[model samples]
Target: MMNIQKWLKHLSFASMAGMFLILVMGALVTKTESGRGCGDDWPLCNGKFVPAYTIESFIEYSHRFVVGVVGLILLATTIMVFLYSKRKDAKWYVGGAMLFTVLQAILGAMAVVWPQSSAVLALHFGFSLLSFAFTLLLYLVYTRFGGAMNKGDGTRLTSGVRWAVWGVLIYSYVVVYLGAFVRHTEAVGGCIGWPLCNGQVIPEMAGGTAIVFIHRVAAALLGLSILTLFLFIRAQASRDSAVYQAALYSLILVTLQILSGGFVTLAIGYDIYLLASLLHAMLVSFLFGVLCYLGIASVQTAERSSAKAYAASRLP
Candidate 1:
């Protein structure tokens, strides 16, 4: 039984890593305009199991292959949780991963079989983000498993803290979707500079520039919201140390995310192209995962807290 539990932990971590790869590869495919590398082919590269390879085709096909493998591992991990654990939170994390993994695949297929609008394409990345977030949360469960998992932590979160955490998490997702829209619509270059569109605080709110401006504004607001959440967590007198620690990390990650955005802009401005885009995506991914952890941690209720405490007193 112990061995089986250990194996499950390994699987969860592998699945989490796979999900991160999928996100980065998907982003790279878009960054390099490699989505059509397979020429609208689905499940097969250019309608053949092995097709002529171009740089684009190779990158796109590789992403598809990785996604296929990652999907299997994620599915297996989800099933293992159901079979071996009675934890409702574990099941939810696994279930959410399974559902979104399928949705992400379907969206990818749609884009390949038939071209989608920018809005639809943007949603593809959003689904991928959600699938990745849930898988990471599953890994978090095993990593933090102990007294906290067995009996709810004694700390009780207030209604306000719950609202703030949920609000930040949801708003971050919205900002991420807007960023995806900017990428899919080729609006990234519309701003031409960081913190300012061209030489102005606000550029002409028309055409692609308008979309980029909106994403920037939304991202700024998201950073502020996260900062508010961090402050809220710190103010809790008897808060679980986990929540305080996660909040501190959240504050740092958001700052890095915003800074990475600026780096992306600088790269574009100087034509000194690099993986700044990938770095930006990575920061957001970590930020989202941390947010999910806090959201789960916040739900540790006090109703059962006293019960657990009383039960502990009876323990020999």
Candidate 2:
């Protein structure tokens, strides 16, 4: 018989992978302008359970089908974790993952059926990202509890390191929202130049140009924040391999994302932007996963610190 713990861990990883694919497919659907491919159909393509043979229709419909399948997988994983895991932490993570997945699906359907403004559609990406993060946390909990867990020598975090982690995580989410806003507003190519919109260091703050400019500014800030985070981790917390490695991975992904964002603008001018945009979206999803992992690690570190402090007090 397969061990239930091992099975649950695998299930958690599977759910996270599925969520990542859903995010990528969603980017494809939007980049290809497939949002209207089904002609306002909700839960069906062009009023049919099986969509017809059209490129846009197939892309959008397939994304919906994949999302549906992933939702079921997440629900099942949540139930199994809740039933079998001994840790209350595991239960909470699984429950949160299930809730976020459900909310994401509802928002996705509403985006299709309702007259969603660009702002609302952008919010959809934010919801999807949150769902992805929760799934990642669930995976982390499963591994930490089910496998040979490593507690990282119980290193104490300095105030600066702690605040850096917290600040970068918060700022990363803001950058994510701005990226989604850029997509939902269809302003991906609104600015024809990188570092500057329209070859100017500062473009006129007017119309969609402002949205694109804001997103660029957020991207630059996010890149700097991640870089600073990595440097801090290397200098102060290098002994904590897990934390240091997570910070390094996040830094690399964020850098790649920034490069892809610029390439997307340039490629779109050459009419090859769709693929670049898809890659850009995939990087953001992966970055979200890494950030979520870091968040979980931070929490565990804090709990360990609290326990040590309490024990030291009792010794007195």
Candidate 3:
């Protein structure tokens, strides 16, 4: 039984890792302008299972292969969880993950087949990230249900702290969308500078510049929000080590993301910064996973506290 549980955990982790890699490869496809390399092919490259030699076609086709493999792994993981896990939460998470993974695949195919505008292409990243988030959540459920992890018992948070954390997580998604927009609209180099658009504190609201500027503003807000959350975590009621560590790691990633963003804008230049941009995207995906975990942890803590209070009242 212990061995089975460990196997399930490993499978779950592998599925999530595959999903993360798919996201990175999708970024590469977009960054390299290989989206049309397959020429509107849904699941095929250039009307062939294996396209005739071409760099763009190879990149796009390889991404498709990765996506297919990840999808299969996710399906297997979901089935395994359903069969072996007795926890209702774990079962539900698995079901939801399967559903989102399907939806993500559909969106990806549509983007290739249809004449999707930049906005729609931007949504592709958002949807992919959501799928990744669900997979991470499923992994956490597996870990906890298999007794590989323990829930943290921490002091009850004031309502203010709860609201603040929730707000930060929600706003972070907005920032993510704006960043995707910057990429899809080809506005990554619109400003040509970091912390300021061109030489001005405010960039001219024209062409891709406006979208890039909005992204910058959103990023700034996200940074402030995370900083606030970090300070609150430091000062608030004692937290479990896992919670503390996750929050600390999130702050660090956000800081690194900011630095990477600056480097892409200054040192690398958009034309050759595909790797850096993709790294930025990957970091944000990981950050979202951490945020989702923290959100669930907060809710679980609240529910346990409420149950304890009710039980004590009945005893009195």
Candidate 1: tens digits of C-alpha lDDT, residues 135-225: 8878777776333433545556677887788889888999999989988998888888888888799799998889988988998998899
Could you say which candidate leads in TM-score? 3
Q: How high is the lDDT of residue 279 in model 2?
A: 86
RMSD of 1: 3.2
Deviation (Å) of 10 in candidate 1: 0.4
- By summed lDDT, which 10 consecutive residues of candidate 2 come out lowest? 144-153
Q: Please list the C-alpha lDDT of all candidates, in the order they appear.
A: 0.84, 0.79, 0.78
lDDT tens per residue, model 3, 32-150? 88988899887877789889989899888898898889889988888888888766766766677677778778888898898888887888888788888877877876664222123
Q: In model 3, where do residues sit more than 4 Å from their true spots?
A: 142-152, 268-272
Q: Give the root-mean-square deviation of each candidate in angstroms.
A: 3.2, 2.2, 2.1
Query: What lDDT does candidate 1 reach at residue 93?
Result: 85
Tally clashes: model 1: 0
User: Across residues 1-316, which tens digit of lDDT does each residue of candidate 2 receive?
Assistant: 2499788889889988988888888888777888888888888889999978899998988988999999899888888887887767667777777777788788888878887888778777777787787777777765543221224435456667777787888888888888888888887767887766899888888877888999898889889988987887777665435676788899999999999988888887566777888888989888977876776666556667888889999995
Where is the poorest 10-residue window by lDDT in model 3? 144-153
Model 1, residue 256: distance off in Å is 0.3
What TM-score against the true fold does each predicted structure earn?
Answer: 0.92, 0.93, 0.93
lDDT score for residue 296 of model 3: 65
Task: Answer with 1 or 3, whichever has the higher lDDT.
Answer: 1
